[model samples]
Structures are given as C-alpha cells and as structure tokens.
Target: MSGFSRSCAAGLLAGATLLTTAACGSGAAETPPGQGDKPEVVAAFYPLQWLAEQVGGSDVQVTGLTAPGVEPHDLELGIQQVTGIRDAALTVYIKGIQPAVDDAVEAETSFDAATAVTTIPAGEHAGEEGEEHGHAETPYDTHLWLDPNRLATVATKLGERLAAADPAHAQGFKDRAAAAVSALGTLDQEFAKGLSTCKTKTLVTAHEAFGYLADRYQLKQVGITLDPDTEPSPTRISEVAKVAKAEGVTTIFTETLVSPKVAEVLASQVGARTAVLDPLESKPSGDYLSAMRDNLKTLQTALGCTA
Candidate 1:
C-alpha cells in the first residue's frame, strides 16, 4: 500500500480495535452498509459527504457522520456510527480535525482528503482565548474546505478513490469530479474579483474558522474565540473590540450553529453591527457552493467591496 493508504488503514484498525474492546460484552452484530449493488461510502462530515455525493453519484451510497446543525468539532460517534464506518466500502475523512470520527473507523478502504491540499498551521490567529479555557491547540487547521481551490483538489482525489473502490463506475466518477472542480474554479474567480477592490481587508469572526478563507482572499482574519463553543476572555473581547474600532470594521460576524450573543456583545462594544457569516459547518440552507456564494455576499457587503 502507498504511504497515505497505509496511514488510513492504520487509523481505521486502531478505531476498530478500540471499539471491539469497548463493546466486548455486547451481543449485537455490527450494522452493515446499505443493502444494494452500490458501494457504501462513509464521510466524516458535511463537506466530505457533499463531495462524495457529487463524485459517487448513483454508484455509491454516501452517509454523513455529522448531522445538519451539529458542531463537527464536538461530535461523539455512537456505536451504530462506528459500525457504519467499519462496514463501508470506502471512507473519506480529514484526520486530526474530528477525533471521535477518527477513532471509530476501521478504514480498510479509506481516503484522507487533507493529504491532497496545503495546510495552514493551526493556532496562528491572534487573541486565541480557547487555550486558556482548556482547549488544546490543533497542530493544523483542517478547514481546507473553506478555500474552493483546496476543496477542488480534495474532490479530485476523492473521485480517484471512489473510482478505485467501484471500478465499474470509474469514468462516471471522473466526469462528475471534473465538473465539480470546474464549478469550484469559477467560484474561486468570483471571490477573487469580488474582494479585489474591497475598502478594508480585515475579517473579524466569532471563531478562528475563517483562516483558510481569509488566506485565499488575501484578507486578515481576527477571531474572537479560538474554540467555537468557548467564550472569549474579557481581555480577549476587549482586544477584539479595540481592533474592530481601529480597523473601522462595520460588522462583527457570527456563525449559524453557535450562539451570536458573544458577537453581539463585541459588536455593541465596538459600535459595529453583527451579521451571520456562516462557516458552512452546518449549512443553514442550500449546498456548499450556494452557501459559499452567500458568504461572499456577506463579505462583500461588510468589506464594502465593489463587486
């Protein structure tokens, strides 16, 4: 096996071993994948699930571990979910981002999408208050899906994996992945043009989830919280407020899944309004592309971009 494949297999084996030990006394058979001729594919979260659906099409049965509106970071895999992972023909996931999912799969046939793209170092953001609040720093930010180009890379790689798993539909997977990549390319261009002439280049978000997006668009992202669920320290809040005022930021952005109270308070302190700038974690509505475009509109309005 190739290095990547070996690593994935190792992770899956580790997860399966743990599950076996934990459920030693349980007299339940593991639930099998969907009963059909189609290949069963398990995706760790919404973004991977969406990619699998687009690429796998009718040839594969794709299941998402993280539900809509659920925070993937805090996901705890149930026994059934673990069984689903173990039984899948193929599993696609990013390692290190979701520990629970990573520890549940016996990914004999699996793909780690994070390996396909360049990763930004985690904990690079200023005013990170989650560390003080008992959240450990992630070595790398796994939110590569935020950047369309990176996601396109992942889609291409995933297509290759899906094709390998279900060779009969290889051509179909390739075709769909190409189309998806093309769409992502267009979206990337749109973001480039839209933010090219923005009045301000700073983005202040509720959490440090927008680093990839900011890097892609050449804007600076200041996160109010390091962890989405943790509240920022009083000093951190004050620091963010001062930065907002100094930058003349018109809005402080919050996400859909998390409460906006913190953002509201920060915006109030800085005399700025609060707006929803979804990270596409739960996808309040629409697919990934539409949600990203909606985010583009929000960013354009807040940054006063010409496009």
Candidate 2:
C-alpha cells in the first residue's frame, strides 16, 4: 500500500482507539461529535467546500482539506486530514485532481463532485504544435469550478447528496441549493453580457485552468505554462508569444496561488501587461459568487469587453 493509504489505515486505527476510550468513559480521549449534531463533511478543496457550505447552510460542519492560497494540484494529505475523511459523515472531492485525496475518498463513502458535471478535456492550445498543457497524466480538465453553470450543477447535486445524508434537513438543503443555482444563473447572464462585445476574443493565462471559462465566454485561452510548477520551454514561450501577437492579447493573466514570473516574462516579451484571472481554487476576498463577479470585472478590463 502507498504512504497515504497507510496513513489512512493508521487513522482508522486511531479512530478505533477513540471509540474504545469513549466506551471506557474516558472523556479526555473521546472525539467530540460534530457541532450541534450537524453532519460532518470533508471537502477535498476550496470549491467543493464552498458548495457544501452553501448547500448545507447551518446544518453541516464542513472541513476543507486544502488550505487557502495553496496549489490544489499539489496537495498532499496529512494524518489529521486523513482522519477527518475517515470519520466524516460525507466526503466531497473531485476525482483525479488530488491523487492522495482520491485514494482516501475511495476508502470511504464519498460524493464524487466530478460526476455531477460534464468535464472538458485537457490539451495543448489548438494549432500550437508540440505544446502539451495539463497536469501530470490527468486527461480530463478538472477545473470545472471556473465555469459558473457547471458549478451550479455541482451545487444542485451536492444538495441531493446532503439531503440523503441528513434527511431531517432535506428541505433546507434543497432550498439553499435552489437559491445558489439562481444566483449562479444571474452570474452567467452577467458574464454573457459583459463579454459579448470585446475588442479581443483571446485570453492569455499563466496556466490552462480556464478552458471551461473561455468556452463559456466564447474566448480563447493561451496558457504560458501548461503546469503551474514547471516553467515553459523556450520554444513553448515563443509559440505563446506568437499567439498573443496574432490574437491582439493585451493582458497576460496570473493566478494568486502560483508564481507570476512566467506570466510576467510572457507579457514583457509581447509588450502586454499582466492581470489577475483567478481560477477560484482558493477563496479570495469573499465567497464564490463575489469572487466570480470580481473575475468578471478583471476580464472586462483586460479583454476590453463591454456590456
């Protein structure tokens, strides 16, 4: 078994110890129940955590496995996080995004969020020869949260799972999910109107995490680096520069969690400025909807898009 699996198994053993302690009436060693009898949920990442909180409202105690400002693609689960997964009433995760989390969730009853929405394929920019952009061996695009409609779909499905887990709060979960869906619909409309008339239809980003958003807004995303941690080769940089010049891309966008060096280098080469186009992998200033609206303003300004 892998190290993560061993950790999870150890966590199970620890849980058993806690149970034994509880039976022996040693309150000091007992694990407390979820707050106010709320069902505990382990969310693999920020987007999933946000969805659970929105759908579950006051009825669920959600623990996010991935911390803010960390690269979700590079998360490695620790013993505490593994224990959280082993003991959660429900675990929510995107399959293939984090391998350790995937293995941990497999050992438990989980709501695979990826199944709730259709996934886009990860690939190099079309017409860019020899430029492959994607996570290590991850064939499907895992950044579904970048698109508001798909995220809304996830919220709806999460509501169903939450209702199933906590039947007494079924109506509350459904109502909150409906409200979230309506809000996402409004955000979608806003994006559609804002990007309808843009001077440039192409967006140059630091990584390939915005394909779904580009598809939704009818814009093309040219990524400077396929993997966030690895630097692009000189040839790949040349190719992206060529695309930027050809597409009249005025801004090269970088994310909060990853370094902006690659984006800055590309922007300098193409005489363009760099901007922030967050993938919403981590909560920025506010909640998911507010961060998306903030992204809309950035997109409008960078792409010269107008309503």
Candidate 3:
C-alpha cells in the first residue's frame, strides 16, 4: 500500500465534502492515466471505493465519490463528478444508496455491486414527526456491505469485471480478489463466533443500516431513524425504547456521519449507554477490517456477547 503514495492510494484516503481531486477516491487525485495504464474506476462511496482498491489492486485507479464524514444517502454530485462517472472504466455503486449517482452512471460501463448478491427486502422506516422516509429504500436494502460474506461476493464479481475490462491484468485482479475474499471470510467467521452467544440478539441502532448485519448474524435491528436527515418521532422513539428495554439492550448505537441526538435521547430514556457503530458509510479511522473488528468488540460489550 505504501508504493501507492503517488499512485492511487492517496486519492482513496483524502476525503472531503465535495468532489474535488483531493476529496475523491484514491486515483482521482493524480492526473488520470492515459490508455494502457491502470484503469480508472469511480466508486460511489467509501465501502465500494475500499473494495475497488482492494480488488483492483495495482491494476486500477479507484476514486471515491462521497467524501469522508458525509452521509452517503444525502450525497449530491458536482458536474465534474458526473463527468467522471461517464468517463471512468467503471463506476461501482449500489443503485439505491444515492439516487444522483445512480442517475449519473452509464450502465454499460458501471458495475452495481448490489446485483452480485441475493438481497433482503428494503427496510421500512418513519421519521420523528410520524412521517415515512428511508435512507434510500429501493425494493431491497442496499447496506449489504455490513455483511462480510455479501461483500466477499461483490469482490469476486468486481475482479471479474475489472479483468474483463483490462484483460492484460486479469491474473492480478483474480489474485487480489481472492485475497479480499480470504480476508472477508476471516472477518465473517470472527463475527459469527463472537456474536454466537450474546445475551441479547436485539440490536437497537441509529438507523436501519444494520438490517443486513443483523440478518446475517441472526439478530434483530430496531432502528431509531429511518432517514438520515429526519429525527425519530416521540412515538417512534417510545416504541423503540420499549424494544430496547424489553430486550435489555445495553447500548444505543450511533454512526459518525449521523447526528447522535436521537440515540442519546433514546439511551437516556432507556437508561442505556451510547456507542458508535461504523456502518462503513465513510472512511473509518482504520480500514474496513480494523473498523469491523472494533465493531465486534462494541457489539460484544453492548450486547454482552461471549468471547
């Protein structure tokens, strides 16, 4: 990864509120390579960008569209970003996460990671005033990356697609994809083993983002916020509070990108502490694997899980 300093890796870490080169993905910061160099791939947000960088390896230049600390569901693309979408070798995204990115991407050149797996139904959420809204409710929940197994599936497909686009690097892509799958497999086993003997399987979260995670590990998710911008209503909060209390949920979870007001309120009402759960919507302080392991520790403590 160190050799990637002047190459694509720098673009991956430098995030911002806009779509500047500094704000975009790993390779976007450098002058885009001419033909026959590494293929340029635009990943819609953080998770995809990380996956692309992992699978693409030294074969591709990856750009992340949504800057770190920004709520992806609320992302709005700049004109340059729209152009980048049209020009990149591939635009990697989950269709429903950001409507604008979905609209901007040229289908033939784009790879929708959501298509690589069998997805669950979209979560239904309501706002603070009893109004209905969602993070980006399509027919299916888009937060599949929360499950390492599902993301492993995406990585395999991404390698195939990248190889197909740049045939010369086919072997390199396959090797890297295999590596990503192995890492994810280890993460999956860790989650399964760590969460296997939890005192409570009910997960009360900041939003409906963890549906896939809960589903994978056989837990239940009670989300406080349906939309990133909207607060949960008093009635909704009360309803979740009941679930938390009944389930003996020790911690109310919040995300870094989203406000903690609702989680704090619910925690106080339910007499539980609050902990930050990285949905991996943005660049976590460490990479995805480290952050997920951190999440494992958080879950183990919050839910009283056995080692």
| Candidate of highest TM-score | 3
lDDT of 3 at 160: 88
> Higher TM-score: candidate 2 or 3?
3
Cα RMSD for candidates in order = 5.6, 7.0, 5.8
Give the Cα lDDT of each candidate. Answer: 0.75, 0.75, 0.78
Tens-digit lDDT string for candidate 3 (153-179): 999999888777667778999999999
Output the number of the lDDT-best candidate: 3
Worst 10 residues of 3 by lDDT: 1-10
Let me know the TM-score candidate 2 reaches against the reference structure.
0.85
What digit string (tens of lDDT, one per residue) describes model 2 on residues 58-153?
A: 977666666667676666655554555666667788877777677766434688877888888774653333323224445677888889899899
TM-score of candidate 3 to 2 decimals: 0.86
lDDT, residue 70, model 3: 70
Clashing pairs in 1: none
User: What is residue 147's positional error in candidate 1, in angstroms?
Assistant: 0.4
Question: How well is each residue in 1-307 modelled by candidate 1, as lDDT tens digits?
Answer: 4212333444444344334533331222222335345556677778888888898888766766666766777666656546546655677888876776667655566687878998887645533554412124346777789999999999899888766755667899999999899999999999999999999998998888888999999999988887876778898899888888888899999988889999999988988898999887664578999999999999999999995
Rank ordering of all candidates by lDDT, starting from the highest: 3, 1, 2
